[model samples]
Structure formats: structure tokens, C-alpha cells
Target: MPRTNLNDILIFMAVVDAGSFIAGGEALGLSRSAAGKAVIRLEDRLGARLLNRTTRTLSLTDEGRVFYDRGLQILASVDEAEASVAGQSGMPRGILRLTAPDAFGRLVILPLLEEYLRAWPDIQVEMSFTDRVADIVEEGFDLAIRIGATASDTRLVSRAIAAYRTRLCATPSYLAERGEPRDIADLAAHDCLIFASRTRRHGWRFRGKGSSWIKAQGRSRLRLDSGEAIRDAALAGLGIALLPDFLVADDLAAGRLRHVLPDLETDDAKIIMLYPDKHLLEPRIHRFVDLMVEALGRERPDARSSP
Candidate 1:
């Protein structure tokens, strides 16, 4: 059988990645009609309907998904071949897809991403900032940054990037009104802001007088899914909150919130990076991971400083 045009496959993949024929064509400097025709030709050659298209959206059929995965492997091989020839001089070019927790993405990752973009002129990034844990492989994300989460999937590689101390805090008014919790048992009487989500609820745990740890028996009257929202609720004097230092350091330094039970020790909120477990990582993936490790492998002195 005659071979299918490789350019058609590239165009189809581009369209899927861009999520629209027009945008995909624009990426390759082709007209929408031309890109659409290329995809149709490829589909005809393969004798399969690849994409389910509507007026405003596009999604892959099962065959398209499989084909796309194979295409990714093919591209990886091509990239590896090019890198072998070019060695260290090879420039990283392609879209880097990333997902990170909402508040942390805005507060921390965005700055690093800005630097990454500056360092690599040919690279582009697509980001999803959400608290919801995403299936990195299924979602086609190159990397995911998570807080206090673990990867259970055997197909993913998880690396711990940083750890931040957590503090139980409340506004002065709330503390004054409710009285400060002198002991862990007192938490039962105070209103606590809990981090609850559809998948799981975050519970506060602290080291006891001995080596044992105990869960805080706080009365959770308000539950929020966002770390920043919990901080806001604490600032509003609604309740006491358990939050990472990075998110509430300024509030504590500015006297907006007071730390509760300063002597008590809490578990650190670990920052982890997750990606597919590929033997040979693309330059974009390895380079970004290296950047993250270099920047956040250890706690930076400025991480807790008030801005």
C-alpha cells in the first residue's frame, strides 16, 4: 500500500491539540479549509472517523485517541533523533501542558513559568489551574504540580519539589470573640474552616505532647475547596483555619491573622510534581522539571517572607 502523507498526520494532530481547525491551521500558517481537507484525507486513508466535530467543539473518537497516542510516540522519536544530531545545541520547541492547584499556580508557578518562557523563546505553555486532581496521561498534560498529594498510578513519576510549614490561624476579632484555643480539645468549641472537596476532606493533625499525633476535633461550620478562600474566611473572622505558610505568611506578618497554638507542630504541605513515566523524556519535560527542582528543591528564604 502507498504510504499516507506524513504532513496530513501532523495537521490532524495539530488540529486536535489546538482544539479547532482554524487555530490549528493558523499554527501551521494554513487556511481552515486546507487544514480540514488534510484531516479528511488522513481520515479517508485510515478509513476511520477520528474527530467528532460540532459548531464550536471537537473531541476524539476512540480510534483518534489511539492514533494520537501513537503520533505522540512517533514525534518523541523524531525529537530524540533531532536532539541526538544537534546535541546540547538543540532548542526545545513545542507546547508544554501543565496543571497545578489554583492558588499555588497563581502565586508560585506563574512566576517560574514566566522565567521559563523568557529562557526559551520557542516554547509555549498551556495551563489548567484547578484544585481538582487531573489524570495527567489521559488529559495529555506534560506535568502536574500538586500540594500534599500522592500519585497512585504506576504510569506516573512523582517527585517531591518542596515542603512548607502549616499554621492554624484566625483573625484577632475571631480569636477575641471565641477565645483562643489553649489546647487541642478547645478546638471542638471553635468554628473551624475545613478544606473539603468531592474526592476527600482535609483534616488537621498536630503532634501531641509525646511523639504521637492527634487529629484536631474542630467544629467545621464552613467548608471551602480553595486554600485562598479559607484564608479569606479566616481574615473575615469567620473561623480558624489550617493553611500553608506560603499562602498566609503575609497575613500573619501583617497582623491580619494570629497563629494559634504556636508550640504545636503540624505536618508540612509537600509540593510534588507528576508526569508520565517515559524512559526518554522530551527536552521540554526534562528542562522544566530541572527548572522546578533547581528553584524549589529546598525551601527558599524568601518563600516565607512577607511581600
Candidate 2:
């Protein structure tokens, strides 16, 4: 094998991680042509095609996968070494890529990020706000903030930053027109604005008469993927919606929306931050997550539902 260039290896890794030569090149301050040529040079040196690339998508071949894994190991080792040397003055100074649920990210995460950016003058942030779950490793995200989500990935670390409660709510007009649902069974008569995806299912869990948890779903005619859309539908008198208190707290207080079953306890909405497993944490990720914990790690009195 020819002597490998460290820069070429890094460019190759970036292209693979980004799933595009253009994006990878942009990250390294290189042109797309330069990035493509570098990867080609790397493959020639190794005497094998590493990437299975089409016009629309780029994927790693079997050899590329093995090589990428080894690259990650090397990068981890380098990161550890750098952290030890800069332990005292280790300030976060990079573009931190984060993914979060849209409504929560806008209402909550964005504020915390504002403070983070102001505090760390050198750090830049890129945020992706969507309801869709992003693969932390495959997508190369530094962190992800998820609401009421549970993860089963061993390569990631999940931490609970805060907790909230869900509220079944509707406008006064809707309540007047359809009449209030007296019990869970009566919910079948009312229009329920459901937040769910095409693949995943959703059910509203409540504490019934015996203080036992029971799962029930109202009749859902309007189903939407966005939490804000669900809230909007409820406000428009379209249906009753089960939503996190954070999204409905303001409306509930302003009397625009009334809590439907305030006495029936609902499941806790957990706010979790997820990140890749690493021996030494990146300063940018650690700082941002710490800020989120500090900002949201408290009981919200205003969000409490009243019957």
C-alpha cells in the first residue's frame, strides 16, 4: 500500500458521512470536484472501489464499511489525545449538528441554543427540526433532542433532561357543539385529532377510576404528523387533541383551549437528549446538553391542568 495521506483519509470519511461529495467538500472547505478527486485517489491507493455511488445517493461498499470503522477508531483515539492536552482550555469551537422534534425545538430547544451560542462565542450550531427520527450515527448528528421517546440503540447514550405531562384539550366551541366526553368511552363520539405517523401508532393513556393506567384512543378522523398542526386543529374546533402541556399551556391558561379530562392523569412526557457514545465527550455537545438540562430541569407549575 502507498503511504496514506491523513487529509485524504479525512476527506474520504467526510464524503461517506455526509452521503454526498458536495456536502463533504463544503465541510472541509474544498470544492466538490476536489472532494471527488481526493476520494478517487484514496481508492486508487487502496486498490479497490470504496463507495457505491449513484447520481442520487452514495453508499459505502463492504471494504469501505470496514475502513470507515477503522477510521472512527483512529478518530476517537485522536480526540482522546487532544482532550487530554487541552483539558484546561477545552472550549467548544465547532459546528454542532443537532436534531430535535419541531414544535419542541422551536418552543424550547431554540431558546437554550440561543443562550449557548451567546455564551460560547466560537461555537456555531446547525439545527434540524422535524418529527422524523434521525439516526445519530448514520446521519452524523452531534446530538438529538426527543420528546416522550424511548431508544434501544446501544451505541448511543440517552439522558432525561426534563419531564412534562400530556393534556387532552379542545376549544370551547368544539366542546359546546359535541358536548364534553364524560368518560373514556364517550371519547368515541368526539373527533380526536391524533398525532401519529404512517408507520407508528399512537394511543392516549390515562389513569382511570382505580388509579390504574388504561390505554384508550378516541375516534380519530384527522391525523397529522406535526404536533403544532394537531394543536391548531384543536384550536380551530376541529377535534380534541392529546398533546404535551408545553404546547398547550399558553392556550389552556388564556382560556382558548380547555383541558378535557384534567382529573384523569396522563402519561409523563419525557424530554430526552441523545448522543453518540464516546470515551471523552466533545466540548460542544457537552456544553449544549448541559445548558438544556439547566434550563429545563425544573417543575413547570403553569403547565399543571385544572379540572
Candidate 3:
């Protein structure tokens, strides 16, 4: 077999990462035809197909997935080598892969990202925004922003970059129709919007009568995975929702949603940055994490400062 060209491999990786040939080509300064031909040449050299392509979508085949995973390992090694050589002058160049929850990523992370990009003009970022909990190591993410950090995973290290509180809130119209819930037990009588996922479920918890934390039991006739959707439901007079204050603060201020059970204190949500344990962390990842803590920890008003 002929020796594989590194440039061809890079082009293939770019195509896989960008999800389309045109966009991949755009990222690497290559024409669509040139990028397509480069991938074809790579596949021919390896005698294996990498991507499964259709008119509307593109996916990695089984072999492609394996190759992509190994490619990430190779890229990490390259990054590590580059970091060693560049030392203090690295300046956080190259693409930084990051993941965050959809609503928070958009509202909070994007603003910090704008500043990070402006300050570090040499660096590029690729972000995945979704509500699903991502497997950081398996997914090859350099950093992940998650709420409610317990740091159970031994393979990863987590740091609390910022904090936030959750609030039980409902629209005034809904409260008027259903009657206000004065205490924790009253929640059982009203419709509650739940945030649930395959692996996780959200329940309302507050500082109990005597200071111990207690979970509020409520009927979840309506449930949704997205935080923004849950807030919308509460705003539309569907039900009361327990949501992060950052999500509902504007609504509460605007009188679209009224805070419920203000006397009982709900648990604060910790905004955590999780990354795999590494002997030598890349400068890009280190700088980005610092940027998050600096920007979100101080600039974000919704971030829990005291608690």
C-alpha cells in the first residue's frame, strides 16, 4: 500500500467535522470539487469508505467512525506536540472543541465566546449546543459546560465556574386560574412542568421548614427536555415550572411569570466546566476555561455569586 498523505487525512477530517463537503472545503480553503476528490483519493488509498452521504444528510459509517476516533487521537497528539514547541508563545491557536447545554450555551456561553474570540484572534472554536448530556472523552470534546456538578466521573475533572439558582415560577394568568401554591405541599395540586431526559430527571427541591432540603412532589402532566420550551409553557399559562433563574429572570421581571413559593429556598445550580484529566493540558483549552470562569463568573448577573 502507498503511504497515506497527511494532507488528505486532514481534508477528510475537516469534511467529517463540518458535516458537509462544501462547509469542510470552506474551512480549509479548498474548493468543493478539490475536497471531494481529496476524500475520494483517501478512501481509495485506504480501500475503505469513510462517510455515508445522501442528498440531505451525511453520516459516518462504522469504519468511518473508527477512523474518526483514531483521527481525534492523532490530532490531540499533534496539539500536544505543538504546545510543547510553542511554549508560552502558543497564543491558544487552533480549533477548540466545546460543548454546552443549548439554552445556557446560547445565552451565556456565546457572549463569553465572542470576547474570547476577539481577544485571541488566532484561535478558532467549534461548539456543540444541545440539552443532551454528552460523553466528553468519547465525543472528543476539549471542554464541556454542565449544570449541577457533582464530579462523579474519575476520568474527568470539574470546576465550578459559576453558580445559579432555580426558581418555581408560573404565569399570573395560570396562577389566577389554578390558585397560587403557597407552600411545598400545595405543588401536588397544580400542574408542574418537568424537565426530563433518558438518563436524568429534574424535580423541585427547596430548603425545608427546619433547614433540611426536601423534594417537592408534583403532578407532571406536561414535561419537556428543553429549558426554553419549559419556560415558554409556563409563560403560556400551561403550568408552573421549576427553572434556572437565568431563564426565568426576564419573564419574572416583565411580569410574564411570577415567582412561586418565594419563602422556600430552592437549590442553587452550579455551572461546571468539565475536562478530561491530562498530564499536560493544551494552552488553548486552559485559556478557554480561564476565559469562561473570568467572564461568566463575574459578568453574568444570573450566576450565583454568594451561594
Candidate 4:
């Protein structure tokens, strides 16, 4: 059989990485039509549809996913070959695609990204910041920073980066008006702001008597999907909220919000990083992961209290 054109595979991978034919083609100094044709040619040769294209979005079919994974392996091999030469292995270059939780991305990851970018001038970054869980492999992300979550997919690798304490808090006025909860059971009478989405709902858990953890029974009248929104709601006196210390430390320190059950222990919000399982990661990915682990591997006291 005639050998498949390797250039077509490269174009296909670029399109998947860039999420659009136009951008992918630009990366390869080709026009959108050229890139689209190349992908079509690749699909034709494989006798399988690789991409599900629409006016606004592009997604991979199951066959496309398999092909894409193989393409990544091929690229990794190429990168490794180049790295074996002198000076190529040390300099990290290329786009690092990342997805992270919204508030944590803004408050935590952004600063780390600044440092990472400064350290490696050749590296470029693209970020998707949202509270919704992302399918890292399917969505074409190189890395994902998640809070209170772990990777369940066998195709991904999970690493713990940091842990932040969480607290139940309310505006002083809200607590004054609604009365502070004396115990976990008393929370049932107070309005609670909950973090919820179609995919997941965060429930508050506190240390119960004798080393047991009990779920809070607070009435959930207001449900928000964003951590910042929950913090804002608590500040607006809309309801009591359970939030990470990194998010609410300033409010608590400034007396804008009062901690409820301050003596009660809540589970630490574990910050984890997830990435595709690969034997040899690209240098850009390896460097950024190293920076994140170096910066956030230990619990920070400043994250728990106001600066």
C-alpha cells in the first residue's frame, strides 16, 4: 500500500489542537480550504469520519479520537527525536492549553502563569476558566487545574498541587438578622447559598462529634455555579455560604463576612492538576507543571488569611 502522506496527519493534528480549520491552517502556513481539504483527504484515506464540524464548533468522532491519540503519540515521538539533539531539550516552546476552575484560575493560576510565561519566553498559553468540569482529552486541553476534584479517567494523570481550607460564612447583617447557627442542625433554619451545576453539586461537610463528618442541612434557596458568585451572595446578605478560604479570606478579615461554626472543621479543598497520560510530555507542559508544583505544592497560610 502507498504510504499515507505525513503532512496530512500533521494538518489533522493542528486542526484538532487549534479547534478550527482556519487557525490550524494558519499554524501550518496553509489556507482554511487547504487545511479542510487535508483533513478530508486524511479521513478518506482512513475510510472514517474524524471530525464533526458545524458552523461554530468542531468535535471529534470516536474514530477521530483514536486517530487523534495516535497523532499525539507520533508528535511526541518527533519531539523526543528533536530533543535528543543538543540545545533542543532545554528550551520549552509551544502553546500550552489549560483549563481551570474560574475563581481559582483568576486568583491562583493566573499568578503562576505570569511566572511561567516570564521564565519561558518561547511558550504561549491559552486558558479556559470555568467551574464546569472539562473533559481534558476530548476537549484538547494539555492540562487542567481542578479544586476538590480528581481524575477518574484512565487516559488522564492526576496530581495533587495544593489544599485550601474552607469555611461557612455569612455577612454580619445576615447572621444578625437570621441568627447564627448554634450547631449543624441549626443550619436548616438559615438560607444557604449552594454551588451547583448540571454536572455536580457541592455539599458542605463539617466535623461531627467524635471524628465523624456530618453534612450541613442548610436550606438552599440560592444555588450558584461559580465560587465568586457564592461569595458575592454571602456578601450581599442573600445567604450563608461555604467557600474556600482563598476566596473569602479578605471578606472575613475585613469584617465584611463572619465565619459561622469557626471551631468546626471542614474538609480541605484539594487542588489537583490533570493531564493526558503520556510517556513523554512536551517540554512546555513539563515546565509548567513543574512550576505549579513548586509554587503550590504546600499549603499556604496567606491563602487562608487576608494578606
Candidate 5:
């Protein structure tokens, strides 16, 4: 077997992504002929036809699609290796890609971007906000902020960024009209707004002084996937909402929403950060993780708040 090198895979991935030898050549600073030769060399070494090319366009063969996918992984590993060595200089630079939930990103991370970008001028960040779990490594994201149980994948590393608790809250007027539930069983009589993503199948969970928890069943009048909408619904007296404490800190203080089951306790959900594990930690990823931790910590309840 001919020992394939990083350049071959890089050129292969570029061509696969760009859809033509000319575009790949332009991207990699090689001539169109050179890029074409590189792909041929890769296919020859692998004993497989990687692409079907015509004068107009290039398309991957069945084997080509499989190889293209693997080649992308190889190129990413090479990039991470190079970045790790470069990161030893004690400065983070270049593009840092991240993904997170939409509402969480907008309400939480977006607010910290100004300070984060100013603090690290060399680091350019591209953030994608979505509710779906992203393929961080395959899609080329440096990090992801996920709110629920971290799925076990050997390709990625996970870390807990912070712990967050859920609140069963409603507008003061709504609570007055619906009447506050004194026990877990009473939740069945009130209308509950369920967060489509995090709520348990059984019901809402509550936490108390010693971290004791009690899950309760409720009738969901409105079911929403977005945290912001659920919060808004609660504010409008639509229903009792099981919301994250971070999402409604202002509302609780301003008397817009009142807590219902302070006496009953539930399990606290975790906020986590995830990244690919195959390569060494680069400066950009390290710096971004540090920045995220600092930002979340600064917003903790004990931290000084606006007076």
C-alpha cells in the first residue's frame, strides 16, 4: 500500500467540497491539473475510484462518497494537530466555531460576545444556534453548549459548565386565579407549560435545601421547544411554566412571575460543553472554554448583580 499523506486527503476534501478541480486548486493554491492529479493519486493509492468527473462538474462515486467522508475526518485531525502545537505560544487566534441552543445562545451567550471578542481580538468566532444536537466533529464545530444528558460518544469530550435548576412559575395574577399548588399532587389541577426539550416523561422536577427532588404530573396547556417562548407564556398568564432559573431571574425579582412549589424539590439539570477528543486541545478552544466558564460564573447568584 502506498503510504498516503495529509496533503492528498486535504486536496481530496477540498475538491469534494468545492465540486471541481479548478475551485479546489484555487482554494489550495495549486493549478487545476495539479488538483486533478492529486485526486487521481489518492484514488490510485486506495485502489478505488473516488470521483466521476466531466468537463462540466465532478460528482462522487459510491466509494468516493465514503472516502470523502473519511478524508474530511483525516484533514480535521491534521488541522487540530497543527493548531495544538501553535497554541503553545499562549495566544488563541483564528476561527473558532461553536453551536448551542437558540434561546440559550441569544439570551445567554450573545450578551457576552462583546466582552469576549474584545478580550481576545485575534480569535474570530462563528456561532450557530439550533435546538438539534449537532455533529460537532463531522460538521467542524470547535465546541457545543448542550443542556441535557450528554450522549456518550468516543469521538468527543464533555465537561459540565454549570448546574441549573428549574422553576415552576406563573404570573402573580395567574397564580392568584389558578391558586398555588401546595403539594406535588396538586399540580394535576393546574395548567403547565412544558419545555419540549428538557421536561421528563413523568412530569416536572423540583429541588429543595438538601437537593431533595419530587417529580409531579401536570396537564400541559402549551408545549414549546423554546425556553424564551415558555417564559413569555408564563409572563402572559398562559400557564404555569417549568423554566430554568437563569431564564427568569429578572421576572422573579420584578414580581412578574411567582414561584409555586418552593417546598417540593427536584433534580437540577446540567449545562455542559462538548468538543472533539481525537486531537490535542488548541489555544482557540482552550481560550473559548475559559471565556465561557468565566461568563457563566460571573452570572451566578452569588456574583454581584445590578443594583
Candidate 6:
């Protein structure tokens, strides 16, 4: 068998990552015909078909999946080797893979990405936004921005970027129609928007001056997976929603949504930066994480500051 070129492996990785030849070609700056031909050459050398192509979609064959899993490792090694040699110039280059929560990614990270892109034109980024927890090490991600507590992984490192807390809120119209709940027990009679079914069963918990408590029962009107959906429901006067305060801060300030049981505290979830545990942080990943922290510093509330 002929030795495979790095360019061919790169093309295969791009196709798997993008899940479309046309999109991969656009990303890699190759013509569709050229990209297809490169894959064909790669498969020819390997003596196995890598992709099952269709008019509308692309799928990885059994061998293709195996190659993809291994290909990422090969590419990562190449990237690291290049970075090591390129260290002489002291500038970070190559693509940085990152992940973040859906709504947070859309509202916060997307705005800041342009700055990173402009500051280091040579360094590219592939950002994935999803609510699902990602295995940074296994997925070959350089970094991940997560809310709530960071996951426990021996192969990963975590740093708190900012401290944030959740709040209970409802549209003024909703409150006007349903009246305010003065205490947790009052929630049993009111419509509350819940994020998880578990939250519905367990209820809300809070701690504050002169009180530490939990509310185990509420009349749930809607259960949503997205934070934005809960906030919107509250704004639309559908029900009271317990959501991250950062998400509804503008609404609270604009008088569209009113804070409920202000004296009774709610759960606090920290925003954190998670990355692979490494002996020496690659200059690119280090700089990217630092830039993200700085950007968060500017956007977070004064009350949410953490050392």
C-alpha cells in the first residue's frame, strides 16, 4: 500500500467533522470535485472505501468510522508537532476546537469569537454549541466552556471563569393574573416552568440570610430543556420560571419580568472553562482560555465576582 499523505488524512477528517463534502470543501478551500477526488485517492491507497456517499447525504462506512476515530489522533499529533517546531516564532497557529452550552454560546461566545479571529488571523477555530456534555479529551477539543459545576474527568482541567446564580421570575402580567407567591408553599398553587423533570419532582432549593430551605412541590405548567425557552415563557406570561439570572437580567431591568421571592435565594451555577490536562498549556489554548476569561469578566455582574 502507498503511504497516505497528510493532506489526504486532513481531507477525510474535514469530511467527517462537517458531515458534508460540499461544506468540507468550502471550509478547506477545495473545489467539490477536488475534495471528492482527494478522498477517492485516499481510499484507493488504503484499499478500502471510507465514505458511503449519496446525493443528499454522506455516511461513514464501518471502516470509515474506524479510520475517523484514529485519524483525529493522527491529526492532533501532527498539530502538536507543528506547534512544537513553530514555537520558535512564538505565535499560536492552527485550528482550536471548542464547545459551549447552546444559549450561552449563541449570546456570549459568538460575539467574542470575532475578536479572537481578528487578533490571530493564522489561528482558526471550530466552535460547537450544544447543551450536551462533551468529552474534550476524547473528542480532541482544545477547550470547553460549561455552566453549572464542571464534570469530573481525570484527563481534564477546570477553571472557574465566573460565578453566576439562578433566579425565579415571572412576567408582570402573569403575576398580576396569578398573584405573587410570598413563600415556597405558595408555589404549589401556581404554574411554574421547570427545566428538568427531576426539578419538578425535587422542587427548588434556596439559602439566604436567616433562611436555608427547599421547595419540593410546584404546579408545573411547562417543562423545557432550553434556558431561553423558559425565559421566554416567563416573559410571555405563561408561568413563573426559575432560570439563570444572567439570562433574564435584561428583562428584570426592563420590567418585563419581575423577580419573585427576592429574599429567598435559589441555586447558583458557576461558569467554568474546561480543557485537557496537559503538562504545558499549548500557547494557542492558553491564550484562547485567557481571552475568554477576560471577555466574561467584562460581561458578568459585579455581584457575581469570584476570586
Please give the clash total of every predicted structure, in order: 0, 0, 1, 0, 6, 0
How many clashes would you count in candidate 5? 6
- Which of the predicted structures, 3 or 5, would earn the higher TM-score when compared with the native? 3
lDDT (Cα, tens digit) per residue for candidate 3, span 104-152: 9999999989988998886778899988888888987888888874437
Question: Model 6 clash tally?
Answer: 0
The better-scoring model by lDDT among 5 and 6 is 6
Span of 10 residues, lowest total lDDT, candidate 6: 298-307
| C-alpha lDDT values of all predictions | 0.87, 0.83, 0.83, 0.85, 0.76, 0.77
Tens digit of lDDT per residue, candidate 6, span 41-156?
99998889999988888999999999987876575566677667666345776678889878888888888888888888767788998766676777768888877654356677
lDDT of 4 by residue, 181-213 (tens): 888899999999998998788888888889998
Task: Please give each candidate's TM-score.
Answer: 0.74, 0.71, 0.77, 0.72, 0.66, 0.71
Task: Assess the local accuracy of residue 6 in candidate 6 as a C-alpha lDDT between 0 and 100.
Answer: 74
On lDDT, the leading prediction is 1
Poorest stretch of ten by lDDT in candidate 3: 298-307
What is candidate 1's lDDT per residue for 1-307, written digit by digit as tens? Answer: 9999999999999999899999999999999999999999999999999999999899999999999979976876687677666664568867688999899999999999999999998777889999887888888888988888563677777777799999999999999999999999999999999999887688999998778899999999999988989999999999999999989999999999999999989989988888887656677777888899899875233121000
TM-score of 3: 0.77
How many backbone clashes are present in model 2?
0
Worst 10 residues of 2 by lDDT: 298-307
**What stretches of model 1 exceed 4 Å from their correct place?**
1-90, 299-307
Judging by TM-score, tell me the better candidate of 3 and 6: 3
229-298, model 2: which lDDT tens digit per residue? Answer: 9999999999999899889999999999999977878888888788887766777777787778778895
- Model 3 misplaced stretches (Cα beyond 4 Å): 5-75, 84-89, 298-307
Residue 174 in model 5: shift from native, Å? 1.7
Better of 2 and 5 by TM-score: 2
TM-score winner between candidates 1 and 2:
1
- lDDT leaderboard ranking: 1, 4, 3, 2, 6, 5
With a 3 Å backbone cut-off (N, CA, C), the pairs that clash in candidate 2 are none
